[model samples]
Target chain A: MHPVSLRKIAKVYHLDAVTVPALAEVSLDIRPGVFTVLSGPSGSGKTTLLNLIGCIDRPDEGEVIVADQAVQSMSDDALSDFRARHIGFVFQTFNLLPVLTAFENIEYPLVLAKMPAAARKKRVLELLDAVGLAERGDSRPGQLSGGQRQRVAIARALATAPKLVLADEPTANLDSQTGAAIIALMRKLQREHDASFVFSSHDPQVRAEADDVIFIRDGRIAGVEQRTAATQERAAS
Target chain B: MNTWLLALRNLLRNRRRSLATLLAMVVGLTAILLFGGYRSNILYGMETGFVQQSGHLQVQRRGYFLDGSDNPSAYGMPRYREIIDAIQRDPVLAPMAVVVTPTLQLGGIAGNYSAGASRSVVASGLVANERNHMLQWNDYDMISYAQPLALEGAAEDAVVVGTGVARKLQLCAALEVANCRQTPAADAPVEAAATGSPAPDDVLALSALEKAQQPRGAYNRIEMLAATASGAPNVASLTVVKASNFGIKAIDDIYLAMHLAQAQKLIYGAGRPEATAVIMQLRHTAQMPEARARLTALLASDFAGEPLEVLDFQTLNPMYRQTDEFMASMFGFIALLIGVIVLFTIGNTMGTAVMERTVEIGTLRAMGVRRGGIRRLFMCEALLLGAIGSVVGLTVALMVSWFINHSGWAWTPPGYSYAYLILVRVWQDVPLLVGSVLGMIAVTVASAWWPASRAAKLQIVDALRHA
Candidate 1:
């Protein structure tokens, strides 16, 4: 079953008197338990499309159905609740609250969900151990390395056990080795948790780790490639 | 728990800004408390001075105030004893004293004879012991016989004189001969008198004659006869016994006390010895209204067809009101200035904090914290700052006030000659401290509200993007 469905989605920004189209009539369906990468060069509307799917921004004219709820018609507050319940987000900057420790950052989503204290503690500890940062839970974001910080962000994103995770260039700041490790961790968590992971990236390492690839040029989808078929095609060529 | 903990953590994250705001609140609250305390002290002092020195009510002969001649003989209230007795029985009135002293006031010829000449002076007489009591009650010293030299034999009419009177007489020593210049002969013309030797002025003459004729520096010894009751005379004279460097110099120099019986006898004669009005002390001033009303009714009924006036300190003395109003205005002005300073400091500090924490506030909002929660967070911080500041400020103020009270700083009030060390009165100052502290808290919280609300209302998107 599809976890996220978008039909003819569009987003426009009014800069002064100019109307800039960020996304134009885009349509797609994302199923559960699959790793998908949306790949494009700069200004190809990859981030905008991710933002729409993440419910942080709304498409000007479109139907965005997440977990069978029509997100396009939801109020800002309702949409916030929806995002908190179903969509976990990872950003390029590893947006951890500087004042909070790794454990606190991971527990933040659970707090927003108002989970019981015991449950929150249990979930946070589980995620911290899962991210291999159980020993570093008390350390603030500034005390952690870039790879560790990204790992903490991923742990925080999955703490609420969200069904759909949107990662916008999550490994853009990490070294190739750290990047591959983070991607592998995310894929492993997805398979175990039965959650779908969607990454907007131009990085080859990120693209290679995906199960399916959606390529875009300008503001339109250029093509889609399945991993097994693409591998066979590449070998044949 | 998580939101509040996050809020607290965020506050500590920006240490310098938070500290700056806290410091401003503390200083503002402290100043307010101190100023309020000072004002209360001054007001209490003034009120106590008023109540103790001046009774809530006074009874006088109807025309005594207007004529400036309130002699007991001329306007005697025949039932003076009855009135005093009646007032003393009342429960609410705190009457301190009920005195019926005679006053013999006259612009008369006073003289002292020596071998060379006799000098002229102004003489006044009062009921002695009672006069001394009145002076002492108002914190004045008793007079001594050594200060005014007594005359002998034919010149036994020796009198105590004010410094001003002494200067006028030009007496080198007490009871020494100071001659009066004789009046020029009017019929012989001014030219003849200027040419003739000025005749020696008569030392024995009446002040009544001095009034009838315009005499030229002629000294008269008005042998004013004052009768005294058998034993020690009730009159006690008040000379410049020991002139202090402080307090009411005019009364010190000019006042004279004589026996009440003597004054009544000399001024009113033997058959009619009476007092103009009676003074009474009650239990307390709070009972003054009922006491006054009861007294007035009694006087009206008992002394039918007679005119009497019941006057209070507020009515008899105009200066008291002026002093009270001036002190009140001074206290008010000081309080206002302090309050303004506190308000501005807190406002500025909170404004800076709100500006710096835009992003943190946005994050909280995005995390499902409501606008009201943000405002509450800021208010709590303000309250904490105010509470801490008030305590510190009160401690400092108490210490300073203590130092001042014990500093041995002395001052002589205007119209006074003696100096007294300054003292801080705690009973009068505690309320001031409380009021000021509360005022500081109020102003600090009020000043912080607008800025905190502004921070709470910041757009989440823009704030999240803020660098």
Candidate 2:
């Protein structure tokens, strides 16, 4: 079964009697164990779509079902619980809390999930090691490179072992090489954990690394491409 | 593990801002403590003065206060035993001494030997020991009145003159009134012998009549002669022995405690040896209230048919109330001013804090923290600030108060001739201190409400967008 499904999702922003559609009748499905990239220019509703799937934002008129539970019908508290249980998110700005170290940043989601401190610490250390940042765990985000910070962000997103992880422009602020490295790390992590990775991006490198791609233009999906197993085997070889 | 630690960390996230808030709280608290302490001290000092100088209560003849002429013998408490018994029975009451004395208000001419001039002076008769007791309570020790010095070949009738009279007369020890007497000059040969005498017997008698007809000063020497009421003279001589220089110097101008027995005998009569009032001395002033109540009850029961009045020091000295009222008003004004300043400081600090954390608050809300949690976080911060401020301020205030008390400042209220060197009083449970501290905390917490509620109600999307 698909991990996330959006049916006829519409989002409208009302600003001073002007009705501007942020997302219009959008419908999509996200399956497990796939790196799906939504590629669009700015204001193309890619981030809006990601927000809806992540349960951080609800559709104005339509249904959002994640892991077979209708998210649009859930109350705010229920949505928060749903998000904590099934979804993880990474922002474009690498929005790390300045006061927290890399390890603490990774542990933040588990804390939100109300996990046991000892378990959280163990999971945080494991994730830090997996992200090749074990040495930098105690260093603040400000003291790390862009690649290392993005690695920390990805580790934080994966801390709770959520079914779906959404990244909004995760490589927007990194150098091309660092961005590529971060994308590679995310893809590797996704494969190892069997977690579905959905990211909105305009970076070609990020788009090239996707197992499937959804092309969006002006708040509507233009095309959808899926890499078959044969194609994955060829790319791997 | 506690969310409060997270809240505290958030406060310290911006070091400069947090320091500013802390500094403001410290200042507000310090001012509150100092002003509060000082006001409490003044009030306590005045209360102590009142309690020490005047017994908590006094009892007198019911009519004595109004008419000022109630006779002591007329309203004497015959049931004094019952009064003492009642006082002993009440646990909350303490009993002191019961005494009786006489008082008189008289105006008469006072003369000096050297000038032979007399001035009108006011005289009051007091019981000697009772007067001494009153003076001692008033903190006066060096007080004196005269007893007559012996003179040979002189009239026994004599007077103890006041310092004012002594200074005016220029009379010293061993001075004789007869030597100092001023006689009217011959009066022009007694008006030329008041027409010529006719015969030897007539001539002698006429000379005696002429001498008698000449105007003479009332007496060669004036005396405050002690006598029986029926005009039988009992001569007793007195001289000024010692004097007092403190506590109402004008008291030296008036005679006091001139032998109540002698006064009563002289003023009323030998047979009517009665007093006008009673003066009581007590071991402690605290015993006065019960003693007064018991005495009043006793008098009412014993002298049921008679009219009497009771008076304490408060009634005798109207200045006590005036002084108390003035001090209270002054303290009240100071408290009000301090309260206003503290409220403003706390409000401003909390407001500034809210303003600085707009984006952080928005982020937390977007992170799915409940609005109630947000409110709790802010309120907790305010409470923390208040608690710290109160503690630091109180310590500072206590120290300042201690220093001021130990510094030994000399203070003199208006209309008083003598100055007192005293320390500031300390009253730990003064209502103002407790009320003000609580008031400060309340003000601080309430002040945080508008800003905290505003933060709580912020739209998550817009807050996340806040820079």
Candidate 3:
């Protein structure tokens, strides 16, 4: 079964008395083990779509199925449980908790999962080394550079071994080299974990590297494009 | 990290705000504790004074409480020995009894023959010498009363007059009426004539004339006149012995004391021993209620068909009870005020905390931290604040109490003669301390509830977008 299936979803937001459409009649399916990107201009509902897929939000009208379960109709508490078990998230600003160290940020989800202490430690240590910041495990978010902070956020996202990882403009705050490196690390981790990677971004590098890219405009899906091997090779060079 | 550790780290995020919030809690707690401690001291002092002055329990003919002030002998307990014996036999009352003294309540006219000094006074007659030792040990101000009543030597047949009565009669050092010739020149200061008496402007000169007309030490012969229970006038002449200060101005102005037998002879005629009341002191104030109840039952069984009432100190002195109730109400209002102030102070702290961590909350929510976990985090934070504040505030309170106690400050309450020092017994106040601290913890946690719920209920998209 597909890890995510959205059927004719609609979402409207009211800003004061004015109505705005964030998404309209959007239908999509995300397959397992694929690196996917929702590419759009600002205000085109990429983040909103990612939020709905992550189960952090629900469509105003539609069926949202994640991991063979109907997510849109679930209660808030049930949604929270489903999300904790099935989804991970990374944010534009690398929303690492300021008060927690790098290691703790990675360990947070495992703690919520009620994993045993020894296993939790082993999982966090492996993620920190995979993100190439094993030595910076004790450093708080404030002590890390933007690139390092994003690495910690990525490590945190994969710590729960979720069925899907949802990131919203995860590289927006990093330098080009750091952004490229973060993208490379996320792809490598996605392949190794066999988890579907769905992220919202306008970055061309992200679009070039993605297995599949869905383009959105004016609150609706514009087109779908697959990355050819030649395009991936060109982007890597 | 554990939730509690995370809460601690969050508190450290804003050191100044956290410290300010902590200080607010500490101050509120300290205010409640110190005010409560000071009031406790006031109640303690009043209780001690009341107990020493009137004993813990009193037994009398029902008529004594009802109307014996008018004719004390008419309501006298002629069989007081039997009642005292029964009290000594009761299992509850026997062990608790410290001093059980028989007393005769008397009212009469006091005068000196040679100096022609006269005044009306109310009096108590007791077994003088032993009671004097008892008074010396208990009444804090009794040390100032000149030489207690002794049953022999120069003091035999002598009555102790109150300072007010002594001054009224122009009695000298030995409480003798003024006689310049009989009083050795060295002992007589002539101050009565030199300074004149303290009187109102219109009567000041008249008082001076009266002082001059009397000599020092001549009227050693003192007389007491009263109407017996049968309404016949009776008089007894005795020597003025020692001037006494009972600390109460109203009592001092007219009180007299003498031997119980002498008073019994003067009022009820010789060979008849009668007492209006019997007062009992207990080993501990806590025992008073049980003693009163058990003794009342014992008295009922012993004096079947007789009119007798057993009264506790509180019933006999409504003023003390009224004062206690007033203090309780005032302290209760203060406690509630402090509680409200602390509540708002903590509520504001948690509210600011929720606002400051919006994006972080959104991230956690997206990562699947439940709303209940968020609420629990804030609640733990509130609990930590209260616990830390209460421990620190209790220390501050103890220090302040020690400083006040050792500061050598003393005050004389309205009806007291000597100044007493302010004392704060912090160690003895464990219940109040524990109770206040626990109450503060509960209040602080409760204050965090709405803010915690607000934090937990934030919309992930909106919260993440908050600047």
- Which has the higher DockQ value, candidate number 2 or candidate number 3? 3
- Candidate 1 chain B, poorest ten consecutive residues by summed lDDT: B139-148
For model 1, how does the per-residue alpha-carbon lDDT over B90-114 read when each residue is reduced to its tens digit? 4433243343233344333222221
Report the C-alpha lDDT of model 2 over B1-467, residue by residue, as the tens digit. 34676657666676776666667666765665665555545444444344333334444456654554323334333343344354445444433543333344333434332233334444444445544444344221111222222221222233344444434333332233222332332122322433222223433343344335433532223334333345443322233332222233354355422455545544565464544444444555556666667667766775676454556665655666676677668766865676666566656766776676766565455445566767777887777777777767667667776887677776664543345554433346456567767876887788778777877776655555566
Candidate 2 segments whose C-alpha is farther than 4 A from its true place: A1-3, A66-86, A221-226, A229-237, B57-84, B91-356, B420-436
How many backbone collisions does model 3 have?
5
Please list the C-alpha lDDT of all candidates, in the order they appear. 0.62, 0.62, 0.81
Model 3, span B1-467: residue lDDT tens: 78999999999999999899999999988888888887777776666666765678989889686678657778888888778788887788889987777778889877543344567898777766445544443332211323455443445366877777776655664554333123233233333433333333323333344445445554544567776766666666666667766666677779888877777877788546888778787777888888988988888888987798998888778878988899889989988998899899999999999999999899888888889988999998999999999999999989998898889888776876557677765646777788889989988988999999999999988999999
Model 1 stretches astray by more than 4 angstroms: A1-11, A14-19, A23-39, A44-89, A108-119, A162-167, A191-200, A209-237, B1-11, B14-30, B55-355, B410-428
Model 2 residue B182 lDDT score: 27
- In Å, candidate 1's interface RMSD is 3.0
Candidates arranged by TM-score, highest first: 3, 2, 1
The better-scoring model by lDDT among 1 and 3 is: 3
- Candidate 1 on A80-190: residue-level lDDT in tens? 677778877776777788889999888888888989999999999999999899899999999999999999989988988888988989889898899889988998998
Residue-pair clashes per candidate: 26, 12, 5
